[model samples]
Target: MIPAAVDAARAALADPAAVAARWRADHDGPVIAHLPYDVPAELILAAGALPVAVFPPGAEQAQAHLQGWICSPARRFLAAARQGELAWADGLVIPQICDTMRGLKGLWQFLQEPAFLESYNLPRISRASARPYFASELSRLRDRIQGFTGRTADDGRLRAAIALCNAVRERTALLFQRRVLGQISNLDYYTLVRASYVLPPEEMLALLGGMDVEDAAVSKPPAVPVVVSGQLMEPLAVAGLLDQCGLSVVGDDLVDGERAWRTVAEGGDPLAALAERTLNAPPCAVKNGPVTRETYLAALVAERGAQGVIFLHFRNCEMENLGYPGTRDHLERLGIPTLYLETQWGTAAAGAVVTRLEAFREMLEGC
Candidate 1:
């Protein structure tokens, strides 16, 4: 018999539209689109709206919508939005997470849709100046949300929203923790976690709560656990490749991965808590902090019990590419092996990545 959690997750995956429909029934508020790796989810929820992550699908018609653009990840996300795959949204929230995403905002702005639109900017680097910048950006976002929704997000209201969101996020984190502890396989975890992007957080949270896999035994010992970092355009391909290479990806710092958890900081100030958590949360190539990319990488490796770190940078992502050498050096200093793979934002390079990953696995085993 299939595990109850897996079965529940599969049901959600089979009819994501039904899930969206259910959310629409409960909440009459506008839907908000959150860009990848941005802090839009928390803000959307705080605004008393449903937060939906937009991504491109693999259908042929979807491809046609994005004909000129190479099959990049951004193109795929746009295609999905154009093809009605994300039609359930009442509005879209675009974040200035990176250059590609910034360009996407302009493209989306002129689409002439009556759907409400909002844009947010999160600090790229976690430096001395980043915290204040994030706080200000978040405050501006709160004002916009209030103006758009005509709702006041006072201390009491923000706290209630934060508590609900935190409950949902904590459940999600426990699910990932179960998988990371080797009680579940990467495939199973990916199936469930990826489904969360398409489903409403409440529904996803309930599904996770129904999961009873905590005591399940692993079929095999987890090989060196590794935390996947950087842009993950195609998580299905990345997770599949990692599994084939015999490395168990216990956790990740990616937006689409374990980092989606909502952080609830104490005090009456929700914006401050949100800003602090966004900066302190897992290592992202775009964050600004005194700690270099290498420091973040090393910390993730140790925290995740990962013997090695995989810096998965997308081709033409200059920020990550430029920081590669320093990141590698930092990992080496901590005696953590590192494998850096650069690729275009599609699964076309899966075969090659698998080969390199297998070699890396062997190298790790020999250590």
Candidate 2:
């Protein structure tokens, strides 16, 4: 059974805007909004502002703003702003990581002027020059954030924030290992991880620390250990299907999953640390800008002792489309079974997805 603390964390994730509203009321915070991917939240936290993720349930009335195969995440963020779900947000930080995100930033800037928005230029390649450029970007962002929040990003404060965040990741890593062993449900584990994006890390850390999970491994009737790679796992029914199939996600290369928590900021210089972690963290399909994800994914599969890999991509994501073929080939070459599927935030097409998972499981079992 998942602990009450974890249940509370899941509840907070379900209604993050409400939680942010409460935080603002209590802390006098200017909440900063960003997607679930890698953007330094420590900077915002160090600046005394709350960093909440812009994850609206669905993109209702957002089609008027976004068009031509725009991903649901972009549409949902716009819809949240237009529909007042993000009224608590004082600013939005859109990262330059994908086409959909870039379009979202352009549209958001054009539509809502006089709103403090920053189009963070996250690098495509982690080259020698990328570190300096990323550090400069972080400095500029820190300046704007200080000016907006009337707080200083002292080395002392930023380091404290980084320490807090790193501790949060360390605690989460424990839960993730338990999840792999089936000591915690995938739904519960993901709910806790997803909540970390929105909830105050200190508060989320306290909740995670309260989880009294047993150490015993609880395997289902039969299953294959699989690594799930994706930008974000949403609608969560996809994870539910994995649980149903008894396929344990031993590891992942998802932007929002292990990728975010596994790599924490390091160094005495907080800005440089954030930039370095951004560039050094798990390579994503878009962020790496090449075929690096294939090698990265293969390494994850082998390290996790996964029998297969499941590549989950948002429907209109170009980065994943470009990298999927090579990644599939790489795993196949290693004799690792794989499944690639396009998923949307709204529906799992439960029957279709579950049927596919069942068939995949059968294949892995035969192997």
Candidate 3:
């Protein structure tokens, strides 16, 4: 099954034409706009829309259009959208995850050629108010989805959507468990998991269902197992740098990685389930639970048997960066070595960043 899943996933990766063909055949109705992280899958499914994440293809010329002033992740998303890579989208739901994303939303709203555009205003990350804020935002989002689709978000419809989303979440959580138990390499897991965002959920599930879970092989245990925490959208290069430097990231608390699909809300009201699922997932910078960011990082490290922790922050991510000093100090008290890397999104080069990672890895090994 793992081999089959690998084969299916590879098919999607190998032939763009095939993937496009499958997408065209399988996807009916409007494609919900793609964002980097934390868009509720239930909303898209309830509205009968496809949730696609927008990302650049890592080509120099493709990135040239984003040169100067604009942050890398923003440029990459914009470049991809502008180049008609997102032509399939019938409408866009842009979540204001960060300042660059907020700016990108404005640019997209202004520039796109007559498509439905909705902006999602996320609640500020805090320990006390995040859940209520998210619940309210979800309510607003449900209304907007109903308005756009010309359908009402009745209780029955929402409950059915919640059940379907719970299934997807369960499947995703199983995959993460397999990875966490050392049944799969981080590279293979990352490839499969990252592709989930861009591909349709059914296709992703099909691929996952086919993966060889039993008798799965594992890579050599990393000398330094690290838990990556905080705001990370396009951290492909950063992960690669860590890998190159002999530090294996066994787990992550980022929306794009392990945290993206960890929990399911079972039984009870649909809205309540939705709220539970959102709050119970790994910590987000925008979370307002009683759990501090430091607690979240320490918990992940402990659960995953990580040797150290790396807090990767994007430049101008005011909330996350401001909270870093405290987070670092708390991790230190726990006897977990922590490293903070402040980077401009999209500007991280694997080779250059690997040097610092290597030193960090050595520190972990010595400890």
Candidate 4:
């Protein structure tokens, strides 16, 4: 049996809008919505509000509002807001990552005209000036949150929020470590992580703290271990499919997965600490940090004893596809097998994806 806490998290993820609505109805503070990758969630929490990570909605819903070729994530977010799936959120924060993402603020304004919509200028290149620039951007974001919530996210509150989120991240790291050890199944592992995106920190920590991985792993079968490097294991059923194919996802270099939690904010100044944490966090295709994505993926594979790497990318995601060739070549040169799986928003676990995974698993077993 899944722990009650984990089960609760799964339930919350199933209907995130309902969860956000309930939070807004119950809390005195506003509910803040943000996309994945960057955007300091601590500022939202510090404002005494719920920080809800808005996942992409149905692709078809976004077709009328955006070009069919626009990345599904960007399209879906716009559709969700217009369709009222995100109506409960008091405001939305969009970080400037790519041209498509940068244009979202204008699209949102022209299409939805939300009461409070703000954008943060997240630096793509990491340099000496990046930290200070990001810190200033975070300060601007804090002001935006204050404007929406009518409550200042003062330093003390920001510190408390940082400590709370940092604690949750710490516990989540432990959870993933347990997953790596075969103490949790892929479905449960990702489900618990997805739960963090919806559930408040205190509640998520409670569930994570109560997990008994020793019991959970008792009946799980051993499988070939591999690492997934991509945006996310979307539609989540993909995780279960991997398990069925005898592949254990031991680690990931996903923007929304392991990368988001690997760093903790430090130092005295909360904003500066957050900026440093953002600049220092694991390098992704979206950010030009000191470490390259290929290097990071290679290190993760070695650390986890992964025999192969699965490069999972959302179809039409320019940024994800742009960095793929080099990373693939790097892994191949090191004699590490790799597979490229391009997925659309709703076609996850489709026959083609399953076929590829099955073949990859067979090849790994033969080797």
Q: Considering every candidate listed, which one attains the maximal TM-score? A: 4
Which candidate, 1 or 4, would have the higher TM-score against the true structure? 4
Worst 10 residues of 3 by lDDT: 58-67
Q: Candidate 3 residues 59-135, lDDT tens each?
A: 33225444475555676667767777666566778887667677777777667653677777766554446767777
In candidate 4, which residue pairs get closer than 3 Å at backbone N, Cα or C atoms, i.e. clash?
none
**True-vs-predicted CA distance for residue 80, candidate 4, Å:** 1.4
Q: Assess the local accuracy of residue 317 in candidate 1 as a C-alpha lDDT between 0 and 100.
A: 69
Which is better, 2 or 4, measured by lDDT?
Answer: 4
Best-to-worst lDDT order: 4, 2, 1, 3
Expressed as tens digits, the lDDT of each residue in 1-367 for candidate 1 is 2266666665665555566677778877666666555554666666777666655444333354434533366675676666676676667777776776777667666553635777788877667688788888888888887777766767677777677767766777777777776676676777667666667766667677755555566776657678777755354567767766778886566666776664577566788887777777655667655466567667767777787988777666656766788878877887988888876544447778888999999998888
Error of 1 at 306 (Å): 2.4
**lDDT of all the models against the reference?**
0.68, 0.79, 0.67, 0.80
Per-residue C-alpha lDDT of model 4 across residues 48-95, encoded as one tens digit per residue: 879888874445457777887888778778778878888878778888
Worst 10 residues of 4 by lDDT: 210-219
True lDDT of residue 220, candidate 4: 66
Candidate 1's error at 118, in angstroms?
1.6
For each candidate in turn, the TM-score is 0.86, 0.94, 0.84, 0.94
RMSD (CA, angstroms), candidate 4: 1.8
Candidate 2 segments whose C-alpha is farther than 4 A from its true place: 59-61, 212-222, 263-267, 289-291
